[model samples]
Target chain A: MKITDPRTAATGHRVSLAVSLWLSLSVLLALVLISIAVGKYRIGPGELVTALINRLQGGDGEVPTVIETVIFQIRLPRITAAVLVGAALAAAGATYQSLFRNPLASPDILGVSAGAGLGAAAGIFLSLPVAGIQLLAFAFGSFTVLLVYVISRAVRGHDPVLVLVLAGVVMGTLAGSCISLLKYLADPYDQLPAITFWLLGSLNAVNPADMQVSLLLVGLGLVPLYLLRWRMNLMSLGDEEARALGVNAGRLRLVFIMSATLVTASAVSISGVIGWVGLMIPHIARLLVGPDFARLLPTSMLLGAAYLLGVDDLARTIGEVEIPLGILTAFLGAPFFLWLLAHSRRGWQ
Target chain B: MSIDIAGLAFGYPGHPVGSDVSLSVAPGEVLCLLGPNGSGKTTLFKTTLGLLPPLKGRIAVDGETTERWSRRRTAQHLAYVPQQHDAYFPFTVMEVVLMGRGAYVAAFATPGRHDREVAERTLRELHLLHLRDQVYSQISSGERQLTLIARALTQQPRVLIMDEPTANLDFGNQVLVLNQILRLKQAGITIMMSTHDPGQAFYCADNVAMLRDGRLLCWGPTDEVLTSANLRSVYGVDVAVVEITKTGEHPGKVCVPVMSDPRGRADSEIQAPPA
Candidate 1:
């Protein structure tokens, strides 16, 4: 007999729910504060806080030029971009896991991320503006998952698990080849650097406009899920069982995939294809508070925001030159992946 | 609305599991299908649910063939609890049960207040109210069965089909699942289950359907079809159809052990003291 309280089975109690929530929020807040503190130009801690306070107050007439530049122009946009991208990735991860009913399933399981990365790179090599690249990334990323869904439905398996995953792999490879072709055709010095930077992933180019478009659509996609978290909970059961209970498995899956894709595409648009956050964030979230989606969604959002922000911080300041955020995440995240693979009784589900 | 099974045959691609089966479940009645291993019991249930297409005949719910109604509409009137559910995701017990409202909810619409309440009540009925928040993967076998039943209850279905609902449960949980079925029957739900255990079926089932070699051997009131003679023919084995004969202070169980005697084994084991 399945029980509701996760604490009673295999893990700690619901009380840990509160602790996880608090920990996520505190880490997110700390990351935000730390992110606000660092940049190409550093502002004194007190002055930074003062500038932030002044900026928020809209009375920043006499602020020091150094503090003003750091807070208003450089740090504010990057920090906002980091938090939003992280939250979106983590939320997309949780959504993908639920939609596919596999713990090892990630947003890229349906080739969405890879498709978007290829689109962004192609846009850059073709001399599309930064905004056009963002748009292309969002469109192609969402399109990849949609294509996977349609093909899987038409293909051999009615169950979209392995079919979609395999379809994703195929599409991802095709997109990757297209990206290679674009690289071969590019002006070596200019477009090669552009495509390479886009591939490695960075937060250097995210602006308020990209963030705004993503925030609006991605937030809309997430709200319905948050409100219908209980339904998402039902969706985790096998379709046969779930339908016997009354869930329309096909319709709900479509909704879930589209919604997850929306957020994932948006995140990709802003972050330029950070690899591991979406794959790993929800797993850590599950480890923290179990899988009740109401708790799980919020926990992922918080941890994802915190984690990505922290990783970006290290990426920006750890060396004299900026390293791509994806490299930093892969460094910290791949070992966790290998550990999860080695120890988790069921690996890469 | 009774479930009418008329001359139905079903099986996998290369194996002909069962055929020429006819049965019905009256409103508020419990029907038990008894069969040995490889008896096509699961296939019969699947055909009725329209999960697998029947090769020979038809299954009707409320006097109409299953094909006449939309799956959702048919599903609204009936629910099934699978023999086992290891194929689920990491959803919660409450969430699992709440999926019973799937057909009722509009496309892309969330579950409303009534749906949540129904799920909660279903959990309460299964004595799983305390387990509503638990993740699905970590639950015990018995609890898993109850959770499935709770999901069925959330459907508010009129006909309930279960395939070996007690296969994983111990004796206590077997009783527990049957008790829930009995409760569903009393609420005017027609219940059908393929069970291997005869003793449990004798008490709970209004009718018993027996299958062998893809054919219905016999089906009728439980007492009529569950006789020792019929049991022997169906199973082709020696079995004691025990009976109670109470006499004063010393009660006796009249052990009717099978007598496949070479001679008239009246004194068969009586004179043999050592093996």
Candidate 2:
């Protein structure tokens, strides 16, 4: 067998990484444009571009009012929400996987999604406003992870990662049961349907305000992760080895967990419990680019944004009634993930 | 740099693996720790590397007590090469070596050009530059061990603590790794290593410390400390320490295990010819 020189191979790898990054970014851009143009109203590409330009240049009334409303008010916000939620979930998944050193780890491994579901279900059962329900969901999601951290800390003398994961499983189960109870008690006439829809997840009701709030929270979470991205590579090497390499593994893990939870909670708050994107997108990204966290973060985010936006487009265009996002993601994500598993030459580990 | 361990008691919480361990390694010297499995050799190495806090002792590096030193400070002075194990990701060899610059790199920043230069230089010195782009998980175990040593060297550490550097390697690879240790010692870096093979200690170690059942059995110069009696006591088997005086080769000692049956009868014992 012949081996290539490292210098040449490294250069080649760098070129490939750059190409992959640009390719994914371009795909996401194309998807975003397609999503904006292909809604129920079916605005033509020329009209879509004209409407966007007119809106950007301060609305000169050249475009039709209905076109403007559909493009700006409905499709734009939904597209933005899908992108943000997908990126946040994927980033969180990559973070959790690296932190736990397990390929199976995802954003929901720490009970954030279950807690958010329970909170949203309660809010709907009590007939709370949309904003109030989202707020409660975010709070519950963050609090569940905090509780798990505390529980893991209180239990002394064990692998901290193992303990945290075990605690998360226990708490997640409890939260899931509570959500089930809430569902059972809800009036089947109205509240139960609302609860079910929220749990199944959708981008149907997202507005500009919800988009802005999620954008702010997800951006806040990503800044820290982006800045500390290189350290995450050390983190995957295990706590003792990372410590030996001069990283305060315990402190770094806390920061990463908190940032990931923050983004996941905020995304779940706006979009309900959209699953599988977090679990699947990072794996896809890992296959595209090798598992250096610094490179993995951006690649995962871009692919995630493109993937969810594409899936959301399918959900809206495939039928009269919009398909729930959670169902579609599982539908699309599972077989694709299995295919990836079967076809992948270099395993994630 | 010199490492001074005084009355060290080390282990996990609620589980004391070893206690009352005291030893020191002078600058540019190699100290070999010989012990059986479950005899707390790893625990001792972890404690010295500051991965585990000492339960009832003080570890000083160059006369400074290290109990309060941050992990970064400890890493700046001491580097540890853990046993070769499976990694969670397929990071390239260069990336793994670059991780050693973590002590010098700021918390928020990635490795800079200088760090890369250092990593490359270490890899080059170890004859590993050719494999720098290979996935770490795809490499052979011997190469993985060498890459780990290259990583430790990248730390620019004063003292290197290696836990069984030659463990799980074949004969040729073991000698290759031992030669690297000797080269590192010649470069004036203090080294402390643990091993299951007494022949390895005779090969490269300047001094030897034997531990059995959580206690230091003996500590002295390698020739005096690694005697047949000490090896027998530590491993519960009889062994002969023989000196080889082959032509055109440097003289050295090698330990040969004396075969015996379960009934305590010598089955194929070979008597050492009169030296």
- By TM-score, the best candidate is 2
Could you tell me the TM-score of candidate 1?
Answer: 0.84
Candidate 1 Cα errors over 4 Å, as ranges = A1-11, A16-23, A156-158, A184-187, A338-349, B7-21, B36-39, B50-58, B64-76, B87-139, B183-187, B211-218, B223-275
lDDT of 1 by residue, B23-107 (tens): 8889899999877777788878877887666777888887888855665786788888888767434556776777778778765
The residue-by-residue lDDT of candidate 2 on A1-349, one tens digit each, is 9885544453243335687799999999999999988867888889988998998899889999999889888999999999999999999999999899988898999999999998999899989999999999999999999999999999989999999999999999999999999989999999999999999999999999988888999999999999999999999999999999999999999999999999999999999999999888888787678788998999999988999999999999999889999999999988977877777654463
- Stretches > 4 Å off in candidate 2: A1-15, A345-349, B262-266, B272-275
DockQ of each: 0.33, 0.63
Q: Tens digits of per-residue lDDT for model 2 on B172-239? A: 88999999999999999999999988988989999999999889999999988988888989999877
Which candidate leads the pack in DockQ?
Answer: 2
